[model samples]
Target: MIRTLVISISSLFLCLFFTACVRDTDFDQAEDISLSPIMELDLIYFNLQASDFYDTINGTPILTLRDTTEIKFLDDSTLQESLKRADFYFKFTNSIPRSFQVDFEFLSEENNITYETGTAVEQGEVSTPVITEFTHIVEGEAISQLTLANKVVVSVTIPSSNENLQGTLNMKSKTTYFLEY
Candidate 1:
């Protein structure tokens, strides 16, 4: 008699479980879902010694130095479509006792400049390093221009440099992207 009672209880519970799972679930609500993701990534970094700006053979001081980095990720169609805005942050630590002008140029595959921005760095010494921070925001029509860039060219210019100059200049930078889909 106990065995029969157990079987009957089990059957009733199974029927109730099946009935509960039959409730209607809305699938159409998924169409209204939206996603917004913010991503930050390192863009560039470099360290420069004072000697790098001096010409050993010519015995002259170089006033400018330039570096270029490819940014192929910006060419992705999906990313271009989803990206709404971008913010670029650059920090410079200067121990060289000379002021600097730094320029960032976004370039296309054909070497045409798509966008450009710049900042000024104050003079500092090894005893006291000067920290300079810069931010560039891209929105509105500028977003389209930024998306077309496939390379970034950085140019650093110093007002005065000498072979005997001491200390170093360092730069760290990052970019933040805001996307909605």
Candidate 2:
């Protein structure tokens, strides 16, 4: 009889202890919850350069710009939206009067995709050297949906001329990530 009484007392004490340990929570009152959602945004930039036009192959002068560059975007698993925009700037100084055509091609190494952006023509008819600048903006959907790690192949074609032209290329990209919880 004593053993039975002890076991009953112990079982009641355990039930009471477990019941007190579990606190009732009202999920309807969400404001009282300690955890909350958050939102975030970010912007990123990139650049590229080419500086030599003095080399010639097979006695033929070459002035085409071929460069490989790296870039970073958001991961695919991240539940966020992003937009990528880019601006390509080319600056050159001509030593003599001449007319030239510029063409651009961009390739993505991650996806093996190629994009033929644009082409421009400029004429320098002055006797003195002059500095010229050209700009191209990239706003394509294919480029905006890039992976976190990527490479961009830049190809520029400029016909060779008797006049010498020294130039530099720069690319600036902006990535805007919109994250909401």
Candidate 3:
């Protein structure tokens, strides 16, 4: 009876020791990632007639255009982890001179956060191209899980004018995601 009790206690201790030594299969890791993506919309046109000025189409105001595009980040699994913060930048360029008001909204469904920014380019020399850039940083608890499905919406408004507004807009986004384990 004494030998059996001793053996049982030793086996229990050995089990506990092995269990304590086991490493976690999943663990958090902190990594910094930078992504650069470019998108272009060609042959964009905005024309508002005098008669249609009072009319609203699909809840959008007259002479206003809106576009929503998905923004990519780290891989799905990596994005599923916690994202401590991110620094975002956008570089906008046009093939021809354009006078319009533009706004950008970055939306994250998981976090229910929107980062909004905008810029306006007044009438410039037609012979010269226009380039605009802006940056936005999100830190602290504002940043949540970032995924590929995140959206970036672009809105442009062109006031009533006799001449039609037309140009190709190119957008480039650079993002640095700081992930936490």
Candidate 4:
């Protein structure tokens, strides 16, 4: 009986020792994630023709325009621009009966940048999207910025002949960049 008890205790100690020495190869600290949400989206006209119809932009009626642009990030904090205007298209039915507003957090910057291809990230790229939506009354078009660590989603709550709002438009590239200080 005593020999059996000693064997059992030794086995328990061996098990504990093995567990303590085990290495967690799969365990890792969570890396920082940057999600930029495009807020302050406006539903208005672009230059001459609306963005919805500029390219092969034909769809169900939509309330918002058809152009979408999001900056790419070098890291979670800094961002870089690859394309100035990302081609975005939206379509909707003329049957919806409710109105809606969209909001996205943007990067913080003092000035709003005018979009140009091969240009540096604009000030607005650092801002969050303001709350804006399409109504019976169309207004000037504006989408401020995409916030870090936020995913921007667009929705149309209105329905009309101009209802060319497209499906979910995501950023073409990761805008936020990181550089060790």
| Among all candidates shown, the one with the greatest TM-score | 1
The CA lDDT of each predicted structure is 0.91, 0.46, 0.55, 0.30
Q: Per-residue lDDT for 85 in model 2?
A: 45
lDDT of 3 by residue, 77-117 (tens): 56546565667766656543446677866676553435666
The TM-score of candidate 1 is 0.83
Which candidate comes out best when scored by lDDT? 1
Higher-scoring candidate on TM-score, 1 or 2: 1
User: Any runs in candidate 3 off by more than 4 Å, and if so which?
Assistant: 1-62, 72-81, 95-97, 108-113, 145-149, 164-167
Clashes per model (N, Cα, C within 3 A): 0, 0, 0, 43
In Å, residue 124's CA in model 1 sits off its true spot by 0.9
Task: List candidate 2 segments past 4 Å from native.
Answer: 1-51, 54-58, 74-80, 84-104, 124-149, 162-181
What is the lDDT ranking, best to worst? 1, 3, 2, 4
Which parts of model 4 are misplaced by more than 4 Å?
A: 18-24, 28-87, 90-112, 116-181
lDDT of 3 at 175: 65
Q: Which residue segments of model 1 deviate by more than 4 Å? A: 1-31
lDDT of 2 at 126: 41
Name the lDDT value of residue 26 in candidate 2: 71
